[model samples]
Target: MEPSEDTSAVSPVTPPPGCPLHSNAVPLYGEALAEDDTERWERLRKRFGGLAPVKVEPEVAAWLILGYEEHRQILRDPHLFTHDGRISRELLEGRLRPEHGTYPLVNYRPNALHNDGAEHQRLRTALVDSFEKLTSTRVRAAIEDLANDLIDAFAADGKADLIGQYATWIPLLTLNRMFGQEDRHGYFLCELMVKLWNGEGAEAGAADQAMVEYLTRLISDKRRRPGPDITSWLIAHPAELSDEEVTQQILLLIAAAHDPTTHLIGNTLRLLLTNMDLRFSLAASVIQIEEALDVTLWQDPPFKTLIGRYATRDTTVAGYQIRRGDMLIPGFAAGNNDPILRDADGNPPHAQRPVSRAHLSWGLGPHSCPARGIAYQIAATSIATVSARLPDIQLAVDPGELRRRPSPSINGLVELPVTFAPQQPLARPHRAEPAPPAPPAPPAPTETVERPRTIGGIWDRVSGAVRAWFGV
Candidate 1:
């Protein structure tokens, strides 16, 4: 499809004025400039509660669903809300209206994640089988090796940006392996996905060219030396799938697998250290680990605020009348945190929604991520392994000192600096504390003849050195 630069990428479809939620608020885009804005969110909630239909900015005119049940209803009933609304076809045919040129595609492809009906089912089944195959026992073992190798490289140094060193690298490498692409391209792939998913305009323009060139190279290589990897497999099994379809599917999978998994690792670590009881409980049981994932997904969803949908026909949702060609944004964070889903009777005010199965992190209904099982296994195993191995891997810096990534869709620490008393088998205390006498004595630190770095201080020095070298 020929690419064009037309500024009016999005235009609102006119709807009836009676809809109470009608708003001048622009649709949210690009890392959600309005995501953390509490007042705006509250206003949105109120409008949504009023059952008024509103046009959100930064997007074409779309209905906003504030009600939790209604959001779920929309997700479930795809007939009323279509994913085929993406403007790919018009662009490809050179018939795309100027206003639609800003979209990623002028002609929409019916990817599993963007379609319903039998087409969705068929695409999802093939993708799911391939993903499950990649997540088998052999893959888990390989991941463990990769993790240990990373730990070995930096664990002794007592300092490293866990996100850069491990989280991003592992997922990218995994996808590279899955696609039979060279290991060297993993980092490039990560960079491309981040740009395409996060930025637009001039930044997007540069990134788009780089990404296309990079992907084309990778695809070309895979075509020549076809292996049992997902890309090669898809290429071989092109029974009902076109090369274009396969490439798009692989692109989406690689991006989703890498970024969200990286954030999941960061989120898990954050929760583990901050909430001691939850960490200990999870360390003791596989089931608890799974439960912890559910709570985390609800509390801090990777796909936080932005949810996109388009109207297949003029439909009234959440008491608002939306016309055909309208768009919709479902606030995932809003719905996940809904009080109705919380367990008031529980010991703590935790979300009661079943962590074992029905969490919305993998999404709900027809477009639910087909890689749910793979995600669970990956998360569960990694969290369980780390928790069991390093029960005391607490953050070296103050909790507030850690920097979070600046994406609205995913929440994670950009650099997780941590220090641990090296893992050692638990030994019974040789000398138990004598009574409560220890509670009475608070002594001042003695002046030492020589000052040396404590394990914690050692990490600090290494951190300083790295920062100095990089001028960060």
Candidate 2:
């Protein structure tokens, strides 16, 4: 597909009446966007230069920035391209209807993701400072312990779904630890988050409410009794955060950190298993998982699209006139494969792209992901842990048989089935009761742990054992 700027790549489908979009707009959210995204990106780029107009919903139109330089321009300039959606033109003009089910997404909140200027600085600094306190050496040790324990729960079975048993748990368990909660809360919160994201009908809504209530309670408890955790750090920050503000930050951090980090680990695992060069090197212990992680971030970013960065005012980007309130999304995956970074045929330079460090997956500017530093640590640690524990692991099914999760927003597999050499399960963490104040109590009772009899409940048993650390 030779690059063209003919402006004739209009879709056959038409936008609804009163839709404030261009004539050539195409649907941005669809199976095509997720399934054959590279092809769709190429087709759209050939006609629309680096930025293409797209219909977000049937009635809403927005710009999809697909060029590397275009991404830098939009992401780096806060004055022109702000993160705040409250000042959006469609919104102010009454085009963004409340019943459309997306108003809440665009509505302004006090969190860092939705704010600008000093407020963003304060909130982001609190997060950065908190993370800095968690030195990499300490963080890695904790993650290594968590990964090893999780592996112990299922390694004896000889086979397991990496996604269900491993990849998915690291982020949730880590979040609970960071928030200074016990294993029980992680189990409770993990179930709630899973239901919130994957449950059906009223189940999703109920789970969301329950999670909010739980977090609120956790924050209140932390205020009364501070601990050496992220929540306590936020609560005691110089910013003097209110309970609601702390709650907002926790919600933002968790939502931003969990899925992306989980998928990053999962994708990296898939690459190391399927790519022969990396596979051989990994088996020989000569390959750094960070390189594999970089490749995954460039090729299969955790998030395919970050929708709705609105124009603060009328502006021209890449020679196109922009209207105030027009929405734009920084196409991270597309920008990583922009023509400038690609060959004359518009294919990414496979030999060089992975080694190059220009991917926008972590984003840019003030609104960039605050959790990026720890995300790398968690993903690399998780991958390293798996490789160390299951050196001979191989895919249970053909690579092509692996299925993606059904969401255009995320690039992740539904499950990763693998087989490895069975090993003796490690001793689970156990809790012991304390002595009485009056007299030496009958030797403090030790709690006995019951391992799951079947592999089906490995996640619950292993993850539930985290309570031993907190004495909960």
Candidate 3:
């Protein structure tokens, strides 16, 4: 593809004294850490051009690509900018120690996200085939059921933290169900997942190890008794992935699903509640839930910056020199707000050209998110279910006081406190009470074990066993 003239060259500018580019201690957490990202990014763009240098965690300096067209070009050509996790050339050369908080981010793993060429294709194919089982209708129904059940837990109280009660739990429960895990195990996994993302010290390391062991056992169980779920589907795929490979794939899927989906729901809800025009449009049936989600994707993507990509060879991007083994971070949030794409008032220039769905929120090229459609379905259903069930719901806290979680990769709120009119629980007419059992029966001869009478019964037993074994 031809490069756009707008991104042809970046004007040269000298970095100010003690700027992020010149200092090793300056941290880069994207707009989430900025009080006002729009003004901040615009200032950075002018000062250092599009490819500005900055520091990530553990005092590692890297380049932050802030141009939309340049970001797209780098993402599209993975051969030049690979997604392998070997970002720190100094560490590989025995020049740096592995005692930093950012060690995990640069550690290589045998998964699609950390590979290129045929290996990436093989791993990604297995994942894509397994995800195909999650049809749009199935995903929508599953998320809706999970969302409603979560809301029901706090509905009578008329007030709840939407992030804890609804946004976070819906994806956790849905993903757990898809992996054929019980509610107890699901809850435990959710706790560990959060710790893995936000915890510090030995506690975080322990949580990470525990998660791997649990998933390893789950994969073994699936191999022994295959079922109609994502894990089983992956095991049965033509790729014939080993237990270790399957475990890595499962971890990737869960991690990828959890934060992004949770944030998408939270961010969209924030927009709907805070923007009167959007709420009015929804009330008047002037816009659909999908449009609301699109707006959120364009404005507040869950991942403000795509994780680091390493340069394969010396190259020039947007007229900026890039050295081999140098780390390049794609600015998804900043690129979305590129001056070339936005009007003077900081809105998308939709009137001048067709609105394209080419946003970099999901990345681009070969390594882009394979479950993009399912993500959209999950977010849309979640937002719609809550909004429809509680039309009077509103933000409980002042919008100005809301805070973002402290993470280098994720862009999400710390909490979303919301309130709604109190209402009674919905009546469940189909639920039937179990009949009373007879007096104790005689002991079975030779202590013979009884098998479940139906598929549902078998699933319940298996789920119970897994949950019990996990002590969840």
Candidate 1's C-alpha runs over 4 A off are: 1-43, 50-61, 87-102, 105-107, 191-210, 221-224, 344-356, 388-390, 401-408, 421-472
Per-residue accuracy of model 1 over 255-349 as CA lDDT, tens digit each: 57776777776687778878877776665664476677777776666665443566667767666666555556566655655545556574222
lDDT of residue 293 for candidate 2: 82
Report the number of the highest-TM-score candidate: 2
Find the 10 residues in a row with the least total lDDT in model 2.
455-464
lDDT ranking from best candidate downward: 2, 3, 1
Please name the candidate that would achieve the greatest lDDT relative to the true structure: 2
Stretch of 10 with least lDDT, candidate 3? 454-463
Per-prediction tally of clashes? 16, 1, 0
Least accurate 10 contiguous residues by lDDT in model 1: 452-461
lDDT of 2 by residue, 1-472 (tens): 1221222232233434654355667876544445477888888889888998886655556889999999999999888887888776556555554444344556566678877788889988888888877778877876877787678778889998998878877887777788887655666766776665555557765665566557766776787789999999999999987776777788787767667888999998998889988778656756567767888888888887776688878888877888877888888878888878876666664345346556889998888788888898999999888888888999999999998765445778889999999997655454232111121111211332222222111111122112111111
**Candidate scoring better on lDDT of 2 and 3:** 2
